[model samples]
Target chain A: MQENFIKATAFAALLSASAAVGLTGAAQADSIKIGINVPQTGFAAADGTSALIGAQLAAEQANANGGVNGKNVELVVYDDQASPKSAVPIATKLVEQDEVKIAISGSYSGATRAAAGVFQEAGVPYISAFAVHPEITRSGDYVFRTSFVGEVQGRAGAKLIGESLGKKKVTLITLKNDFGQSLANGFKEAAEQFGIEIISEYEYSIKDRQFGPIVAKVKSDAPDAIYASGYFFTAGPLVSQLRSGGIDVPVIGQEGYDSQKFIEIAGGASEGVIITTSLDRDSDSPEAKDFIAAFEEKAGYKADMVAASGHTAMKVAIAALREAGSEDPKAIRDAIAGLTLEASTGTISFNGLGEVRKDVQVQVVKDGNWHRHSIISDPDLLAPPEK
Target chain B: MLAFELLLQGLVQGSIYALIAVGLTLVYGLLRILHVAHAGLFTLGGYIGVIVTNATGSLLLALLVAMPAMGLLGIGIYRTCYQPLLSRPPYVALIASIGLFIMMEELFRLIFGPYGLSFTAPPLQDTVAVFGVNLKEAELATMIGAVVLIGGLALLTLRTRIGTASRATVTDPKMAEAFGVNIGRIRDINFFVGSALAAAAGVMVALLNNLVEPTMGSVPSYKALAIIVLGGLGDLRGTLIAALALGVIEAYGTIYLGNLLDRDAIAFAFLIAVLMLRPQGLFGRA
Candidate 1:
């Protein structure tokens, strides 16, 4: 009994020491570790690394300016592999094992959805950067994103097409996954509201390469424009096949087309295409400029919106952490819901579930590049365009 | 316009199905092992071809490197993962193959990064218009390459000594072994040949689409399984015919459904019906 008591006492001592280390061990703590969960490899590998680089640059810049509460931030990353099945274990490791209080993630909506549940259960705050699924915010208070839901992007895209570009006959070519489908559905509702006739709609598999038949049928519909909202893998070929078929209609897409490689794949054909996205690298916002410059210098490549979103998510979480002055999940969640930061993207403020409520911006693909096309109307806009 | 475009596109996709299925059928004919790992190898080929193109900036060089690399990797994988399990339950090797597929895919993810690699098909981006229907130069190339690969596989099986030995081994492994034929060597060669063809198919896909990902092989791999079942597992002639049929059917299905219905469902559903009707496969040795 004495031996058992001694062992228990030793274990308690160790626990106290670890807590001391976990909390106030700043001098010896090396840095405040925040887990960066994204798909660093797999289908989302490219954007995953881009997001990681943003987190890395943010942590670096934060340290350069003397980190949060004098504790340098450390980013310990785990690759969610862009698969829902893979995200659970990685989130488990981050929350239960690594014990990081805050994480930024979500390369694929499905993966983000899978990880969000794990984080909420574990009382760890997770910020999704590029995953814009509307359902993700419903995961709970602990889950948040720098990017708004697809509903926003979709409605904005439909508005831009209906009100701005003046095209009525439309067709949607979307990835059939829930994330892509949700956006398509959102666009469909909005387009109908705008009195647009979506002559036809098509959904492709996530890995489908040949878009020959899909594009051909859309051409038959003779829609004034097409909306393809999958990533470069599927979208590139879709555009290529469209061009080959002489369907030369103006193609507008979602955030998936924001990557540099998208243009690289679509090349000459991608010119004059437009896509709705969170923030363009060429944003006139000073914060956006600074972040882009630092990111470009660090990664030795142009920064994508996904990377910018991740850095912005960290900024949101870190700001909330400071406001709460504690690592408690509930406190942080409340602080995030009330966050108001002039971030690189825009003024980020969240609704009840901690998802940012922001305007959706439409960007045009011109000269084989994505450039701001229009400021998508919000209630805050000079005037919300006529309904 | 949509139907016409869908037809040409479906033909291109169908061609790819043919390329992938032929190799799968070949392996089943000789080894009697349904290698799920071939998909991993197929995906590996795409990524490898991308890397080769990036580093060397030569499409030809990328093909040269990825093809032989996949072939050699196939032989090595068979020796390490399958050879020992050959004597064990047949299902054992298949399960091991699934594990190996996971491991190889994870390793690929580690090495290749998750985002797909893009190959610039500047030359082939040009299209040829026939009967007011658009056909991409890349798709045409893909079909041509598929034909060549299938033709070569057929010729190799008919003419070569190793091919004859493989035939003998396929007819009766025990008799071939007693006749002093090196069954192990034949298996290794067969695996290498199958994997090499899959790599070639990968190159075609990458070239045709200008994109490749580690998980890219999964869809084609599953399609190959569907085709094998439909064609009669061990029957080469039926596999080819099934590939074309699947390709055309999927293309039309995508169009008829107005793009909402995924064409893969058609292949999968057909596979289920076939399994119910013919447990031994449509064209497998009766």
Candidate 2:
């Protein structure tokens, strides 16, 4: 009886304290709350930090333009550390405690996929900035992806390798995970369509620092080119090791290789390495020019593909909020599902699954910078099926 | 040619493992503490080495600065974390060291902004051919530096007065203290040297991989722990042999078997087999 009395007293005090705090919060909360989940640490820290900067830039631009529905836009960011375990709690805090109306994810596929379920159950619209896994948008109606899916980019890569570059024979070095395998699957499926023959395929763990043995295998295979799938950290060293091993054929990579740090780590070996990514920094489009200038001016470095996706995701969110004219998450989700805007990457429109349909830009590293080589556009790739 | 290249690659990676595992073994010999935070020191050395390299644009300067910096840090760690917990159980010290490791990683994240730093020296970019195998100047330097440093350490332990004092303390601290050996001072010197060796390995890794991250030391450090145990707790020579053998086995395993069981699988497999055969390690005293 005494323990129950103490518990009751403590609960009353907690209620009163929270009520006071809640009143204060309601009085001062003039800005519409948007949550951003990104990895600020771990293996993907470099990409995560750039994505954070891009999201911040978008929020700043929206505020400068008087924000959505004439209210200031505020972003509450949580670092998932690129792990699903960390992302789950951050998602809960964003919805249950922070009361954020919407969320934008700038993390890898694992964290984004994990957090999408949390936001969906809570009726919050979750926009993925750059995670390309197809399962991400398939989670729920509330889950949306502003970036192209992995299969789209992979298909584009195969088309570029076979049709444009005329590389008939290729050796694939996949990173052995969802992002790598999904991309590789798309590449394999479309390789035959473009008359490209996959000579050999090999897998490498993400934790691998040395590529000597793998490169040796590739050297012996001696295909026309090598298609490597991995992030900048692995991709950079892979290129360096491959070149140092005297295998100098054209090395094609996925969007994971699209970072300035890729050039930094690979050094001169990054030159002539081709990759297919969603964003083209050198594009003459007004959206590209404006975003590049603003992001670089703010971040002190050139924006990469992931960064552009962050900016577009936030812009799309704010636009949806403006059209909805309220803080209702379902209305915002509806507005976003119907959104058709010209984003930094390309024209942004969602299919039934909320995956973005856009052109993947083929870029090649030239003289320590990414130069636009060509673009592969597929109209039916992202279109929703006719009812 | 492929076999030859794999051997060279294994030797380089094994040399780094030898440097790291040897330090852990040395600390365990004297303190009886696992010293898990030693990995944090290795990571710190890598970060500091990168900073110094960028500032000075000299690989030599980076090594010179990083080694001493880590040595000083070792002394600091000993004074604060280890010394206070010395009177407690050895396991207490071990657990505290794990805490120190976590704290150091978090501190690094806070300071370095959680981004991986690229370490590059312009002069080290050139490739040198040795025995018909192409190697970057940085890779060759790492191999040569590891050999010279290990040899120098062996000589120091076998010949020098301080080395003898360290050995005396390690053998029997109470007896050495009773004989006026100042065991505490010997332990400090031991930590300084061991930490310096780890720092050298860290800088070499940053140079070779061209990337230095805050969490990079954790895995290598844990692997070093496995090496020390597989080498019979505190056996230096055994550690060296095990390190090299594991590196070669991993390289070959990744090539022959699929990458599904390449790195940790090969190391642990060799370890389990060795344990089944000779539980005291390759060169360990039974």
lDDT of 1 by residue, A129-165 (tens): 8787777768877888788677667777788788888
Displacement of the residue B285 alpha carbon in candidate 1, Å:
4.4
Once fitted onto the true fold, the runs of candidate 2 whose alpha carbons sit more than 4 angstroms away are A1-28, A380-387, B119-121
Candidate 1 Cα deviation (angstroms), residue A225 = 0.4
DockQ of 2: 0.32
What is the CAPRI rating of model 1's predicted complex? acceptable
Model 2, residue B47: C-alpha shift (Å): 2.5
Query: Which digits, one per residue and each the tens of the lDDT, describe model 2 over residues B1-286?
Result: 8898888888888888988888889988888889899999898888888888888898789889989889888988887778877777888777777867876776687688665788654447678899988887877887899889889989999999888888888889898888889887887887888899899988888877788777878777678887887888877788888888888787778777754674656777777888889888777788
Model 2 vs. true fold: TM: 0.93
Q: List iRMS (one decimal) for every candidate.
A: 9.1, 7.7
lDDT of 2 at B250: 74
Per-candidate total of colliding backbone pairs:
10, 0
Candidate 2 lDDT over residue span A1-387, tens digit each: 234335545765785476446433442268889998888766677788899889889989998998778788888877788899999999999999889999999999999999999999999999999997788887889999988777777778888889888999999998878889888988898899999999998887777767877777788889998889999888888898898888989999978998888998889889999999978877889998899889989999888988999999999999999988888888999999999988788888887888887777889999999989887777754332221
Error of 2 at A97 (Å): 1.2
Q: lDDT (0-100) at residue A272 of candidate 1?
A: 83
